[model samples]
Target: MDDCTDRATKRSFLAGLGSLGFIAFGTAAGRTSAATDSQNTDPQPGKGPFTDSDEPEAFVDDVMAERIGTTTPGATVAIVSGDTPSLTKGYGAADVDADVPVRADETVFRGGSVGKLVTFTAVMQGVEQGVLDLDTDVNSYLGDSTVTVPDTYDDPVTLRHLGTHTAGFESTLDPDIVADPAALDSLEALLTNQQPSRIRPPGELVGYSNYGAGLAGHVIAEAHDTTFEEYVQSEIFEPLGMTRSTFAQPVPDDQPGNLAAPHVRDGESFLVADDVYINMRPAGSLSATATDMAAFMSAHLGGGAVGDTRILDAETAETIHSRHHVRHPAVTNWRYGFHEYGNPDANLLGHSGATVKFTSYLLLALDHDIGIFVAYNGNPSEGPKAVVDEIVAEFDLQQAPTTPTPTWRSGGQERAETVAGEYSLTHLPQSGPLQVVDLLEHLTVEPADNGRLRTTILEGDGRQWVETVRVRGGGRARCPGLRGYRWRGGRAEYE
Candidate 1:
């Protein structure tokens, strides 16, 4: 809590926007490790002290195999201990048509906005070197004088605000696949022409914004007098030896060989989607391998450097993770680009990535010196989330937030009344054919029996997460057995 930025609310809203984690996944529910154990015994090469068993990797191996069975095809995973990747492997085919199997070391998957970690690291480096100021208006470094912001709030959006997703910009891009490179627009052009409206004041509300993050990347690029792609390549990727990664859309000419083709599930199988390009590559559209991401993850795990190649100094790394905003204590909050993910009891930070077809997840148990990453080429009915959850459960969480949950009728009901309403966020499509999704943005919370409240928080996209939530203090409610998520009135909030 070192001068922790803004406080309170849910990190899940960001995840709802396709970014954010903690106490990680909910309980395994009907899925059990005991059942998975009997299904597959694919063992790894090493063991760790996470569990009391002699074969610690056994649980993870079993879990991976079982979970992959539920997916269409192709997932690469990596788990690191300290600066070393203790577990790294692949499952199924990279291209079912080509019959090419996925290789953990070579196949690439879109990192999505998790690439914003690289973007934020670059911005923070700018702050460290006095090239930029975190608290100053971003328009100053934007290099375009005519670009104007909607006069929605008195405060201007700043670098720190973008890092924690409090820039208040509405969604300007759609989840529709940008399959043609010719359709791409420059970052500034995208910002200028399709400029999103600033719906709230800066640094006040926490809404996961791809536009805000992409703008931060643009600011860093302008500060360095370079393109965002060039700046990251020379500063972050090369330093960390993440050679198999690229922000360039249309899969750079020399690297398309390594790119994993996007796939979608039709009933019980994965069908390859056409190659895609994203106009807002800064927000999403990063193609990388799990092995490459592990190197990036290892750099953070080892305090911003790995073997003399330093992307960020120790202090810069810590400052980057410093909390910038929280809407409720019940849900997780942003610490710069990462989230206070996993069990609140355990010191963890991570992000999740999902494109139209591909999905990825990253986790760093900082205190335990562990980093885990999983990326898949296809969207599955079950999703790859269960895999990450099982991995998170391996860590020893020390009874997160030991305070007993205050039961209903004991002053919690009064708090529920004040919070019941229709809350909305800005993650919806602003002006696309998909803008109809804006209807999905509004969440209605009403008091249920026994002092609990109910709402359809996030039920679409293979999720039924928000059904019932227990009222907590501060106009917030915690959905029992769910990850930290609370709602009220804020940027990504309900009224």
Candidate 2:
């Protein structure tokens, strides 16, 4: 209990980093009155009060109203429930300097890593077309390109590994953002020059890599004999009528609608910041509007079709939402191109994204047939994710966190002692200037009374955990919401 409390404290501190500012708006009275009244009158004991079919505009308005103009200059939001857009709205300013108000239908915000969903969608389309295989060596499709995945380990890197971020590529934490759009190289050139060395065996670990994402996009392009942008533009954006979305960096001057200017906090005000270009377009270059995103989300929620325009068949869409990689049983894990949001037990698939100055988050509640997307013009320590978290919590889109029952094993103390130690996340950069992030974020585990273990980070409060044997020779240690344990070289690592 002490450990869970401390970890919550740590999470609070981390979430504060991207906190957004907002301007209050007139409440949409009676918008959700039906749902609110029912929820208040007949509350369920263990479920979210609101239903998936409830009108969410009022709730979303309240969430955004609290943070406009304080952290981000402007923001866009989209919510789709049961194959229809319930709300698509914009608030504050897209360019505070020019005093341009964001229009949910007209203003474009960078989707950041949220765009990876589109890239991965294209990959699935190829799979449906029999042009791509998730388990095949990625090199098989890269024969026309200069890039190649070296035989760094016994198992060759596969599309599945890349999609799951388990390709073992060292984390560079960069998608090659450049100051000048002119400096941006072709997708092929950027991937060839900036490829990171594979540091572990394929599928052995989950190391989030921009390189891996870019590689996946390059593979799709190679397989289809098309540029990454061109492939998605035809298969995804055009089919779904996402006219305001594009992976072209600088967002094509001729593209319709205005681009939302990125912002930075300036005391109590905000200053319009320069927008950078993504060299690896496939990884994080997508710029889109809330309205366009709503359509995209609806397509997924509607089983890969938005009003009869099908980008993927039902089976392909389901496979895309299925779990592809798991780092732990209790916490968030990867699902194809998307990662699990909040509770792993919850049937929610999501991904968070950011450029240097913009941030965005997208989530799909598969069971509920609902999808939420939010993006901000300014990258704060806490941004769109906070809004998504609040929506999920309010709607009961997923199971809330709960205390885990301890396995009353006979020899917990012995196992606890065997696994207690300071360890770093293997997915973090192992070598480079960014390696210090691993050092600062490393975990320190200490045995506690009654065979429970206490774990602390370099700076956060200690968390309590219990041990259970998950495999014949491996150990499983879990906290309230986090769980995973692996033993290698006589060392203990937790995820």
Candidate 3:
């Protein structure tokens, strides 16, 4: 584990998040304490979780149409298994102001962080072509002249490190991300101009780094001598026939009316998110139809090919799916661009993404031969809680262990003050001078009884204390009282 010499820094950061009216955690709490505490009633545990025994008829549809719609204005879902897609459906209004309903086949929504999966797929394909090496120092490619990583030591960041999120880059969140299309910067220029700090030694810790993914995209662009979007379009999307999918900003000229407008809930209206351009298109902002995403899911599961259009060699595909670095052995690990969470063998792989208004989730249950994609055009606290996790539970992908309160001798927190500190998400970018958010986002830990520690999170209105019921290894705190978010090395490792 890394040194805990920065405990006061950690506490100040988390305490800051709690002080910010607890806005982040409030975004995902969902329903009430009574509802979340209910036992699992899925009889098959294999077929579905929200079955008739647990809820009303057409439980999945009910959630998409009613529960999710209560917050998000529009959403689309696609479920594919084996050779065919079992479901491709949409719910609620695409444009509440225009009275247009969402359609799974026609409307497109931002895929958010799921786009990283597509980006890494291309990176792996390039590796197969012998154009790049996963273990080579990435700076050697981007060049010490253009982008320099200070204090890299013996082991510099590599493509594999970037894919597994162990590259040790601190987060960088540019508040001006939401800008006009013309105002956005090129991937290379952005990487060179606003390079992130290497907070940890390479391959030392698994902190989700979007900056690393974006940097990888830039490296790919440099190698191909083309824009990141163009490389992905010509190599991956076109081959898979994801015609409506795009990484380009400004929605492109050809796909104007097709892309769904961003929206958020108002009392009775859906507020249209302003036409703000996203700068980190490589990190997120991939727009595609649910039907198109299914094709992607199909290709990855089909040994990196859809029909005969081979995207990556079968061997390369196998390599990407294999575990590269495992943070937890029994639980799961990171496989190239993907990380395992819910499955036992860690066969299932995917990502979840979000912006101010848009949220998306993608899961590939390879063993089950099923791929699921869900995206909503509005920001809702329960967007993922009710949509993704519930659905994953239904498929019974893997038997993930839950941290229940142990009755044994029990571990206690003797080094509470030592462990108490703030952790900023490695996935997000840490603004250089704009320290407000970084301060507010800090997660503070304090000692508590029963081996528990009081932690603060940003959610809903503001900051509040969330006590952890159990403390795990590597200075990690498991809040069984909450959603079982495990924090180690001053960062949230997994949920």
Q: Per-residue CA lDDT of candidate 3, range 380-458, in tens?
A: 6655435766776655666655433333344455534445555554444455564565555655555666544565666
lDDT of each: 0.64, 0.74, 0.64
Predict model 3's lDDT versus the native: 0.64
Of the candidates numbered 1 and 3, which has the greater lDDT value? 1
RMSD of each: 7.1, 6.2, 8.0
Best candidate, lDDT: 2
Per-residue lDDT of model 1, residues 1-495, tens digit only: 100111223334444444431101111111111111111121333444354332435666666667553454677877777666666666666776686777777888877767778888889899989999988888788665345556577888788888887787765545224657788878877777767777666766665677777788788878998898998888887778788888987777787337777775555555667766667767777788777887888889888887788888899888876677765554566788887775554667877777766777888877777787887676543445557777766555223443343343465556555556665644454455646555556665666555555555556332222323455556554544222333434423531
Q: What is the lDDT of candidate 1?
A: 0.64
State every prediction's TM-score relative to the real structure.
0.81, 0.88, 0.76
Pick out the ten consecutive residues of candidate 2 with the lowest summed lDDT.
28-37
- Rank by lDDT, descending? 2, 1, 3
